[model samples]
Target: MDLHYVVQGNGEPIVFLDSGGADLRDWEFIAPSLAKSYRCIAYDGRGAGQSPSPIEFGDYVEDLKNLLDFLDIDNTVLVGHSIGGRIATDFALTYPQRVSKLVLIGPGLTGYQFSPELVQRFEEIQSVAPNVEKMAQLSLELPSYQVVMTSPQRDRMVEMTKHNTLRGLEWQHLWKNLQVWGELPAIPPLNELRVKTLFIIGTQDSEDCFRIADLFKQVPDIRFAHIEGADHMPTLTHSLEVSSIIREFLGESKL
Candidate 1:
């Protein structure tokens, strides 16, 4: 499918996955900085930017696997944000040998199911706004809201979001992965995980995400960092800090 991707720098592979509604552009600022130290690879997820939507989340995973195979990249660092983080986690779980490290930003663990009211609000937001202004407004006012991203970053995210909606996919497809995701799948035992994992959560993120991280504390080789004052989109607002952590982790890892 020729999924759009940008590769930079001259070191070990680091594949970046954007948030569900965001494209590779979300990493524009952060990626360049990281590229100076690692061979960072960023690409648009399906249904966003230059990528096309497929029937299932597994298709998205297959696309990632194929991309790695084509690039001859093994033992890589998989970095993902939001739904992108979930995707990275899933890929690492399924193909442990291919991933040497994982960095999740404001990641949504499987156990972090949405409340009925929150789901309804999401639907309401989509129905009323259907455009960038309303969406940005919702981003600011929503109680579950976190820190408000900078205008430029918010604008870019909103622009990419225009192409990232889930239309007729239903809540399950949006939530579950062809029956591949659930409480059982969402919270995997990191004790069993061979790769080192890092979770970067915005201190202002929805409470459910925080609870999920707390729940998974038993997982070995897993660490969590709270980006104080940063919200859901730290990659946009706090790119430098995010990039520094990634670079440090990569430098310390053998792969």
Candidate 2:
């Protein structure tokens, strides 16, 4: 499928990857700020937004590769969130020469072993099934998301969740398959990554995410930052701080 994408600004290329439940608009608040000096590209992943559905799990890695090839892009920075981060990591490892830098925000690890408690929580969430509205509402009600719900970007975040929920209902089975089938193989050792990497995590994100970040600490060329009071959606809840961190990492003067 030809994914829907938007590009802005000029200079070094930086691609923004959306979370599993979001589209390119997830970066609406943060992308423009970075786009002032860098070429920022955000795209809708398969089954989200205008993108098509029934995307095979294994096809995600290749979908991104194809997107870059079609755009004639190379040696660019990849900034990804949640499941998007998984895609970015896989891409960087598989095509190291094509990636200049990697920014993982609340990233998901490949072959992650979910805690039994987390698994139970997930099962409960799944039990709600096709009731996308309730699922979306429940997501926001989580303690991790409370901070974002009260922030200035709350409306946008809610809208994005609703949009994602609708898409989730539309492609329920495909979405479930993507979650299971897209499971990546064992991650390569951190030392093998020659490209610069940054991890920006929310202090209040799930424990599993924190554990994943701990594992990335072994990477030689990597930096870490913790956003207080933010959660998985830090890009939305803490846009200014997130953008500033990205700007600093890229060595760009503040706007």
Error of 2 at 133 (Å): 1.3
Model 2 worst lDDT window (10 residues): 175-184
Give the clashing residue pairs of candidate 1, or none.
Answer: 110-186
Top-lDDT structure, candidate number? 2
Best by TM-score: 2
| Per-residue C-alpha lDDT of model 1 across residues 1-255, encoded as one tens digit per residue | 477888988887789998766788779878888777679899886666676555555466778999999898877889988888877877887899899888888776654666666666666666564465566466455553445444456566555555454332333345443332233434665567667888888777777668767765755788788787777778887787887777776664321
Candidate 2: stretches off by over 4 Å? 175-185
> What clash count does candidate 1 reach?
1
Report backbone clashes per prediction.
1, 0
Give lDDT: candidate 2, residue 58.
45
Model 1 scores worst on lDDT over the 10 consecutive residues at 176-185
lDDT of 1: 0.72
